[model samples]
Target: MSGERSRTDRTTLLARNDLVFIDFDGTISVTDTGIAVIDALELDEAWEIEHQWRRGEIDSMECLTRQWGMVDLARGAVYRMIDSFELDEGFNELAEAAIQIGAGLVVVSDGLDFYVDRMLGRLGWETCPGEEVIKRPRRCIPRFANHGRVTDHGVEISFPHRSPDCDQCGNCKTAHLQRLRAHFSRVIYIGDGHSDLCAARFADLVFAKDALAEDFAQSGRPFVNFETLAEVNEVLLAPRTR
Candidate 1:
């Protein structure tokens, strides 16, 4: 949370028509929570299930469903594991900058909503107490990801945001991006995994790393490469020379 920028600086640099869409898990969080959950629960087969999704052998809904079915841990244990995860150091600063500049910031993920909700709650991005009482009320960031519920048997996954026609992704980031594009003049997408590929293709500007970066590099697609959210904040709030 370093290099804090002033509200005036952000307002001057950031575009009012820009809508920033960020991916959770590896992009914001230090580790991918879905993989973390599988590892924490000692579900060895889940890795293969994920690989199947990566290879296009299975859709994300089946991938998550099959993987979660292997989890035998209690609900409390799962939640504790999720709570142990950490977000990128600069995430809070970036989020604050977006708010200050009056830019729409939405977190779109292919991961489960359970961990997304827990991680965002750490930053007070879930829900504020009351906007009337607070001077600058925090905006509750919207999340689009698959739903997960821990039960006595195992974790049950449901896709409330899934595209009726597309089976490639459970949450369908591309569909969400298309829907948001109607409202915003420009869309800036930040992500680091295979799940972000479809959405990145449709974004006005893309900040990529990890697998998504590699994919864009191989395809010769235009994108800004970044290893940290600090870099993203720097680019977004950098003073215009022109």
Candidate 2:
């Protein structure tokens, strides 16, 4: 991190310093872990809620809140099921690249902190209460997202960083990115879903895939199309021609 550099010299400024924000659900993991849980449990009600959110009948916060009630299975059972899911093969490489470059990396996801924390822990990184993990270099990669608690009734969700102005996402990614922009000269966002659209707009650069790529295309927002963390690493860690 350094003094603010004018956006006019963005090519040079962004080359050396940037804060990278990544999404978890589909970006880091191969698929959405939450949906994987629903499928594993065969919770029909959860599917209906997801459909509602997709069809614009309800917001993501509402959809997730309601869906949690349908997950009546025990915590251990759900954890075992979700463990079958896989992470993006290049996540470690990307993380290591970010660390080497002295760039700030934060996994700002809308997914529940429970799975996020589990995944981070499995990657050998220590996590904090809010799923925050700092693997040396004196930079923070906190998992700013919703949280879930399993109980006898079902899973209960808490939106710790819900946006006061927007109800679309449980943990609004745009708000988190804006806060990061205050300190970082360039904000690089990577994502692959509807929940990431707003934050994508706020980012200086975006690596998008699936529905998110289409959203950026339709809206005429420039972004790099990528399907793997390898692609992201190649671009971010490459030598800047400018």
Most TM-score-accurate candidate: 1
Q: What is candidate 2's lDDT per residue for 1-242, written digit by digit as tens?
A: 22223334435222435787889999998999878878777887888888888877898888988877777777777677667898886777766666666677788777788788788667665445323333324433456879887665667898888889777888888887776677667888889987888788888778899989998888777777888987776666654421
Clashes of each: 0, 0
lDDT of each: 0.77, 0.74
lDDT of 2: 0.74
Q: Model 2: residues >4 Å from true position, as ranges?
A: 1-16, 129-140, 239-242
Tens-digit lDDT track for model 1 on 172-230?
A: 88888787777667888899998998889998778889999999889888777888988
Best-fitting candidate, scored by lDDT: 1
Candidate 1 collision pairs = none
Cα displacement (angstroms), candidate 1, residue 232, comes to: 1.0
**Compared to the true structure, candidate 2 yields what TM-score?**
0.85
